[model samples]
Target: MAALSLALTALLAGAPGAGADEPADAAARGPRLYVPDPNPDALRQVVDLVKAGQYRDAAGVAAMVATPQAVWFGDQTPAQVEKLTRDVVKDADRSDATPVFALYNIPGRDCSNYSAGGAANTAEYRAWIDAVARGIGSRDAMVVLEPDALALLPADCGQDDAEGTRTAARYVEVNYAVDTLEPLRGTRVYLDTGHPGWHAVSSIVPRLIKGGVGRASGFYTNASNYQTDDANSWYGKLISSCIAYVEGGGDAADCPSQSVPRAEAQAWLDAHVHVPPSRMAHFVTDSSRNGQGPWTPPAGKYTDPQDWCNPPDRGLGARPTLRTGDPLQDARLWIKTPGESDGLCLRGTEGPEDPERGYLDPKAGDWFPQQALELVRYANPPVL
Candidate 1:
């Protein structure tokens, strides 16, 4: 645990910090993940804490914001997105860092859930992707394309038409993004699988392939959820192996589910799923807020216990980096900024106050000060 803390502290010191530098090889060329300006609200939190004479807490907030996290782009015009993307890549270039750009504007995104907003149709999405790609032309950047595009499809959440028209378009939009962005000289595009806990290996591999994981770098799991690093890694390995099997003409349905005991799953992979690391899909996992693992709501307390929502007591997970030990695991990223809320979590209740937390959680993407403190305090590998 102390070693892990040391590594996290190094990462906080700088991307690919001591003992975590990216290989010099061309395939893994990102020098370090870029650290952009901190979110304004986060900056405010630090200032407020200091003014209130909480110097130690203020430093903790400052430290948390200094770590690298992905910059999300969605709901922007083609002209706007292109400029924004160009500016970010240019900034990272100036800093000699490779920024991770998370694209989130897919049609019918998030199944109209809390983080609900997207392009109105496939054409707009395609255009937006093109602008982003153009902006990233020949620049060094990693693209976590469309967080829930493949994970929470329209059909999966019953938001599709009777003929699954919207769902079909969703696939087209995602495939278009993959096709458009993955071809860039410096961008590595990853598809989505929501998280390890949400989709079975069998269920998500097919979705990944259909969404064009084969053409891109690989897929990402646990985008904004609190699944542990071990669980996410195991899930990624299984998913990547399944994709390889299917690419080699094996059925995805034959892949082992995460529920299968680990020993058995490894045996299954050894016996059947064989593709060299370079030949197979490689994955990244979100370690933004998995430190304390997941929040376990008081059992049977709320009817709709939205466990994924802003559950208190969660902590920041592993620091973002380009070097993960596993060859097939490309990166462990802070895909979700640690101190932000996941929306007003009603948790199946009547009043505005969340019964679970006894307070109204901030709206999605808002800076959550209380949760921020909890994240730093309970952080398994402490954020401070």
Candidate 2:
């Protein structure tokens, strides 16, 4: 409560409004995030570890879950989603913390891959977004809208009609969500760009503009993927600057990308992107599993390595915070639930086991004890 009071004071000193444009320093120095109640499954894991005489590990798991992370909503009816959203926002309000919501129910989400599941079509999806907006009515909340929605479209997944109808609808769905949610008094919406490692600056900026980045607060990177803070932040800066440049009548094709040398990219920004930090699209990065950074499998290990799919020996990144001194950046968040399996990673082999790990990884979103312990043990800054 005392810390909460100090954070509120700091936010007051900055700008008024949650997710609204405040002074750069005030937003950077804003209050610590509202930590949600621990997941019941996570609590049970801690208890199980205690019974096993693994007190230190139990404490680590407990500490990890206690830290702030996103509250995800997906695959629910409009009524159910509204209530669920309301419940979370109210709970966070009691703690004087701004809740970060990951809205993941966009149509054709994950491209029918391991994590595939979403609304049936654009109409239903828009209704869901409206319900979410209602659920979050008048509460300060941040939305990392639809991970991979912009980065992986139906066209990219070969699910598009001949005219790319589904792909065009994908853009419509995302834009509807942004228009619906961003107008709420206290909601800030950030569209996804997959991760720094996946998309180049020029490629993703166009997707963002088409998907309604112009009307939204900003964008986020490295959701549910491991790219080091240095990498994620640099990638974020490039994309933000590139988007600003394109929005200012410059060509996205002319925008610098990660493929260019770092010195060259910085030089390009210096030459063209003249917008101040406040005018540019701000961003957040996922630090949930980047403490150990990304994993590198053996060379030519498999035809489809799926390196993003639960590669071993990863650890947690920095704790979630709003006071990240970088003005163009907003916060570093745990967008993915750490310790959850990415899915069964066969690594292109016809087997049930994850070849690299020598076991069948749990289904995506399932509690994974082995991975959970590994994360706590290897967590950067030490989980405990």
RMSD to the true structure for each prediction, in A, is 5.3, 6.5
- Candidate closest to the true structure, highest TM-score: 1
TM-score of candidate 1 to 2 decimals: 0.92
Question: What is the TM-score of candidate 2?
Answer: 0.92
- Candidate 2 pairs with clashing backbones: none
Q: For each candidate, what TM-score against the reference?
A: 0.92, 0.92
Q: Which stretches of candidate 2 lie over 4 Å from their true place?
A: 1-30
lDDT of 2 by residue, 182-236 (tens): 9999899999998878888889999999999989999999999989999999999
Instruction: For candidate 1, write residues 145-250 as lDDT tens digits.
Output: 8888887788888888799899888888888888888888998999889887788999998888888888999889899999999999999999999988988999
Residue 376 Cα positional deviation in candidate 2, in Å, after optimal superposition: 1.0
Deviation from truth (RMSD, Å), model 1: 5.3
